[model samples]
Target: MSSRTQHSIIDLVSLEKEKINRLFSTADQLALNPFIPSKGFGKTGALLFFEASTRTRMSFETACAQIGVHPMLLDGKSGSSLEKGETLEDTVLNVAAMKPAFVVIRSGDDLDFNDITTKLQMPVINAGWGKKGHPTQALLDAYTIRKHLGKIEGQKVLIVGDARHSRVAASHVELAAKLNYEVAFCGPEGFLPERFDVKVFKNFSEGLAWATVAMALRVQLERHVTKYSLANYRKNFGFTVENLKGLSDKALIMHPGPINQGTEMDTEVLQKDSRCRVLDQVSNGVLIRQAILLEVLGGL
Candidate 1:
């Protein structure tokens, strides 16, 4: 079934109509409203991330500011007492002591503790939770999909590149399934996620030919460590100009950025493809994240 539910925007299945409507409406009003750099004076806040971040981190900070919420930023790796053997739950719980409207986190591993995800008496919005989910990215992606395609119910959205290992792709996979998209995955054969119901692919041509949206993932610099060979990594499942020709004219291109040049994809494709919305993805992220933080922290 559709992921738009009623109260919670936790997942696609749990997202409801009114909540979505509110989000879009808020975003619309925000666009038409004033120009304030720091609108989030008292309503919102953000937590630090131990891992590297760009879109996910700044977008959340921007989102909160758009909705009039002041931010309390922290560094994930260097901030707090985490280096002294502090657990994720304890650290989050301690941060919660400040009684900020909501706590946003981005951990590299998928460790959804009850104390953090459920306890703490306040809402905990996962900025990009471990290996599990990046709900904000999913939101912006869905928004981008809807903006470009109008509706996603039956769209054949192919998530190519690093299928299994990406928090972005993983979240997209789960949400795509929940929203009834014809979701498929592609990567180096052995790198694909084994647990999902989506169709997996090894050949870029076959994957691109049938897709309405071709979503490439970022190739981490550590593909050498994970896969043991950069040359093989490029040869196995990398995206090149040759693969681009396989896409149908109706097909739109996408990528989660911080792109590894000439590794997973060609930079020119992002620029040359008339249907590419990679920049739009970042722009929409700020709007969608504003929507999420507002819903979670607005009334509280």
Candidate 2:
């Protein structure tokens, strides 16, 4: 069995390429037979999400159930103790003391996982951590890309919009770079992150033409770095219907939802014929997370 106990997927680059490939293979198997029997039966997983989530939360819950693990979810808006005054550390201690099979936490940007994991005895998976990284998303994204495109290596991917505040984009960048995929970002001037050797395109059209995959990102209002110009955003960077004429037929559209329909992409672009893989990402999320759970709960 794989020995990924106590491992936290903080960043994609930190994971060995072989392990990643193994996880992807596992995910592919799980996708083929979601109801297949496996380990992790009778085990419990804690879902402690401090932020609002749709895909990550639901897909994780589905994965746990599919893998025969009981999942106990704790949301920030659900009148949890954290809403009153309890600190994350205190809450973590109390939760960890219960000795659940594993803990899946989606904490704020500042909560350092490197420090937190050292203190924990059980595996602590990062569901999402601030604007830093969402490793699982990256895994599933790579899975989706590989599923459709045959391989992630040598694929030209363009991550568009909200680059600075998107944890998914950061994770994808690291994963793409590690896997030797050519990755670029296209967004407004101030929205892009400061440091990265990869190419940055100011024009989305240029990016769309160059990439085999175009991954659109949501404009995060929660991370409020600068004012979003909707008109300019649609004109310059969005996957508008008019721009579809210029888009390469070989290039497919992707979005880590929940998408702001009219903002990053037009409503028409979401249709079946638009070649959008948003639903594929959602489908792969379950299998990828199942692989994560299996890896972290290895042989326990």
Highest lDDT: give the candidate number. 2
Best candidate, TM-score? 2
Each model's RMSD to truth, in Å?
A: 3.9, 2.1
Q: What ranges in model 1 sit over 4 Å off?
A: 1-13, 28-41, 220-236, 298-300
TM-score of structure candidate 2:
0.94
Q: Model 2: which residue pairs collide?
A: none
Each candidate structure's count of clashing pairs: 14, 0
lDDT of 2 by residue, 162-203 (tens): 888888888887898778898899898877888677799887
In order, the Cα lDDT scores of the candidates are 0.69, 0.82
Model 1 per-residue lDDT tens digits across residues 79-158: 46877888767777777787777677777664563335556556666677666777678767877887788876788888
| TM-score per model over all chains | 0.85, 0.94
State the displacement of the C-alpha of residue 297, model 2, in Å, after optimal TM-score superposition. 1.9
Residue 108, model 2: lDDT of 82
